[model samples]
Target: MRPPKPTVAIISPALRKANNGNWQTAHRWSRFLRAGYDVTLASEWAGPTAGDLAPACLIALHARRSADAVARFADACPKRPLIVVLTGTDLYRDIRSDPAAQRSLELATYLVVLQDEGPFELSTAHRGKCRVIYQSAIACHSHAVDSEYFDVVLVGHMRPEKDPLTAMRSLALLPDDSRIRMTHVGGALDDEYLRAVQALQAQTWPLGERYSWLANLPHAETRRRIAGAKALVISSVMEGGANVIVEAITSGVPVLASRIPGNIGMLGRDYEGYFPPGDAAQLAELLQRASQDIGFLTRLRQQCAQRAPLFAPARERAEVIKLVADALRPT
Candidate 1:
């Protein structure tokens, strides 16, 4: 007979929307953990009383959103493991101002930072409690249609923080004969972004050229397009460990990411595809060179390939299990 399953509570800020990174990670991690454990996904704690909420382990996402649950676990059962997963804002912003977030980090039995360099921002005292786990990716098989003119695709929600407009602006700066079309795929988050996308699409720029903008493609269809594209551009102002980046690399497509800590941690500091954040001119120049210069494109592809190994499903699972084992070990 099978042994009893270890019941675990998985919490995240986004439960209904499958587009967010935290939600996908929570769902995927739960599926993997289900072999040895019974996992239930919850947006927040639903205990009748403070003392009623209990589980063998609690895995919480976001430093601020999950802070209260972390504290409750600390008060109710200090011995049980409380794993807190930090997001982009939590690692780079929230911890600086939110007292609850700070307390959550301090009270966690073990902390899971999605990218490699996440622990450096923590105090030396709290550093030892952290572990790095790159989110896993599932490679998809798609028709990588040959192309004489390289295609560039950008996949991200049209939010202010994502700076999706910069991609089009940069593409506009390219010379007339660059032979590249930058396609922007994302849902507009607000009126401002929608207007900006509309205006950019109609503008006579990028050597009097324009890119096709799709409102939002289905997840699987998006992956197929990404796999066949010459490159994927990530122009985010801030990111924790982007689900898009992992998806791009897993599909063997190259990525030109912004030079931010979040992107650097996953792609490595020396990656050749970085451009200054929000700099349209620089991004355009790089895009022009990546299309005209064969060597530059090859280097970018190779760099992504090297980084791809870090995000394998088995590797992530093993890293997570090891961290759990270490945290549960008696001192």
Candidate 2:
């Protein structure tokens, strides 16, 4: 007889085809967890009538979108462990007013936050159960300080919170002769955002004609771009924990990010490469300094290198396995 596997199911708000952050995280964790567990990925619980739907444990991503399935699994299998992973919207918005989000939290046996400071955002009653797991990526050591254009790359979908247009607008603030160029990756999520990006592409802001953009790529190629960039730019207005920031650090791509709670939490309070969120003028000034000053570029690269080990593949896998193992322990 074959040895039985510990069955684990990962639920997310999106289908595999959606290619959103939650889906991507779910997919990666499920893949990693399969080394010791029989892992399955789904959008929801098929339920009491379906024999195969119940697993030894359930791991749900997104408080609001996956709430129903989380609730159902918790109620159906009260003894089985259920872990809920919180997303960006949950931290800054939905958990504040959404009842479904609240219920999901209430039912969870354990909570996972992507970055260090996320547990503090939860209520005192739920705080003790939270764990911080910084997402990891394969390391890439390529740096881009030599490109003639002094390229600045931003990798995010065209969404409101990504504030995708801010960095491009900041380029206009650089002196007309500045060599800084910008690249905005990821597709626009809506027609309105698409039009805004199109309009900006044709205009003369931030060095006027100094930018190029690509709308998404296969995972392998995206890492290559980060490996080659002079710097990676993150313009998010809010983020729970950015996988791309981890990607950038692992790839040795120094970053210029918006100074939001999420960014500050990841990059450390004293790191110098931050601009106020939505402040195009300040972003422009930073770009100019990074371009013209050799010492500043050196410092950014050194600082990022010091932080790179935090995202190593072995480290993330260890944290994840430890979490799952602890959850399955006989208590």
Candidate 3:
């Protein structure tokens, strides 16, 4: 008789209902592993019961939020492989101070990070076990962009960590003749943020009269919008590895990113499209230059194209498969 496939449990703090990066990652991974393993995904895993068969491996997303599940899985099956995937907050904030997050790192047999620079944040003791897995997005051909105005799309929720205000404030700083039109996507997480955006929209722009907040569209539609834009802006104060950045690059849309480690990690240290985080004036200048300077836009596109292969589906699938195979191998 043929042997049954080994069961692997994937614990993600966010679910389909959340419609966020964590859920997308979990869902994608489940599909990738389905051929070789029986994958089960949940917000938490209590482990197999006394009479039930334990999973051969556990993959948990978000070290801080999924710490309890990681601990439980390790306690329940000491010999079983446990993998913990780190997020932006985990690397930039949580692991530095939170005990639970730190413990998760120690307990995990292996650690996964979404981008190349993530390993630098790990302590020397845990660094050896870490691996980089860049996320993938299907390539979409560039759509015709509007010629009347230079559209710059920002695709992130209205959370403080995202620094949505930088984009908003930058619009006000643009010269009156500048044709840059800013489009902000993603759902508002709170009433205050919603009000702030609404307030910005109500103002008469000293620059070109174009600013719209199309709060939360379906993922497909968002990607379509991104593919059609002149450029994409990522203003996050922190990001483990933004799926949106991958989407933008795959769609042939150049990116203007904040000069933070996460963005730097994905775009490379020498990419010319970086502005200091929260510097509205600098962001405004870049927007103006991108709209007026074709050479600058071409450079950004060239750089993004060079990095595109790293985020290809085949590469991601191979890495994920290897990660699981290595974890399941007998010592």
Candidate 4:
């Protein structure tokens, strides 16, 4: 009889209902690992049951959010590998200050950061064990775009970290004749943000209804909207890496990203489609240019095209499988 495949457990703080980047990542990684191992996806892990063997490895999605699971796994299976994947908040906000997050980092056998610049945020000791694994998305056929409007999409929850208000605020700076229209695809997590979005949606801009808030569409529908848009905008103050950027690139859509380390790591430092984070005037100028300047828009598209190969599903799958295999190998 053939030997059974080892079990791997992936712990994500966000699950399917959350419909956020962490859930998407955990779901995708589970799919990838299934080819070589038995994978279980969960929001938390307290250790294996009384009669069951512990998982061969534990992959925890957020350092701070999944700290308890990581701690439990480490204490229960000291010889086994523990991989902690750092999210935006973990890298940018928590690991530096939060004790639980720092402890998770210390306990992990290997650490993963989604973008290249992630290692820079870590100390020298932790940096040695970290790897950069860029997230991937399968390519999709572009939707039939509306030529009447230069559509732009922002796909993330209405959270403070995402800095979505900058995208909304940019509309007031656009010229009266600008044809750019913004479509937001996310649920507002806070009452203040919900009210803000509602208020923005109610206003009529010179461009004739510039903003539309489609609260939390299904992933397929969101991708369809992204594929049809002229460009994608990510105005995050911090990001480990964004899945939406990968989706946009794979769907042949360009991106206008905030000038942040995580974004620069994904899009490259030379990419021209960057504006300073939370700067409405700069974002508005870029949006106006994207709508009116065909040359500039084309340049952005070409630049995004150059980066698309980095996010190929095949490449990511191979890298992910290798990481698991290495982790499972006897020390």
Better of 1 and 2 by TM-score: 2
| Residue runs of model 1 more than 4 Å from their true location after superposition | 1-3, 16-18, 48-53, 204-209
Please provide, for model 2 over 37-106, each residue's C-alpha lDDT reduced to its tens digit, 9 standing for 90 to 100.
9998989876656556578888998888889999889889998899999878887677899999999899
Clashing pairs in 3: none
Please identify which of the two predictions, 3 or 4, would achieve the higher lDDT against the true structure: 4
Q: Give the top-scoring candidate (lDDT).
A: 4
TM-score of 4: 0.98
- Report lDDT per candidate: 0.82, 0.83, 0.91, 0.93
What is the C-alpha lDDT profile of model 3 across 117-167, one tens digit per residue? 899999887889999999998999789455878988999888888998888
For model 1, residues 1-331, the per-residue Cα lDDT tens digits are: 9786667888898874656778778888887788767788988865336554477788889989888778877777788888999877888888889999999888888888888778887888778888889998887643567776778889888887789878877866777777888777788989988887778767776533558788778777788788878888999988888888898899888889899888999999899999999999988888878888889888988898899989899998888767656666677
State the lDDT of candidate 4 residue by residue for 1-331, as single tens digits: 9899999999999999999999999999999999889999999998889898899999999999999999999999999999999978999999999999999999999999998889999999999999999999989767855587888999999998899999999998898888888999999999989988878877765633998899999999999999989999999999999999999999999999999999999999899999999999999999998988999999998999999999999989999999999999987
Clash totals, every prediction = 0, 3, 0, 0
lDDT of 3: 0.91
Give per-residue lDDT, candidate 1, residue 140: 64
Q: Which ten residues in a row have the lowest lDDT in candidate 4?
A: 199-208
Model 1 lDDT, full chain set: 0.82
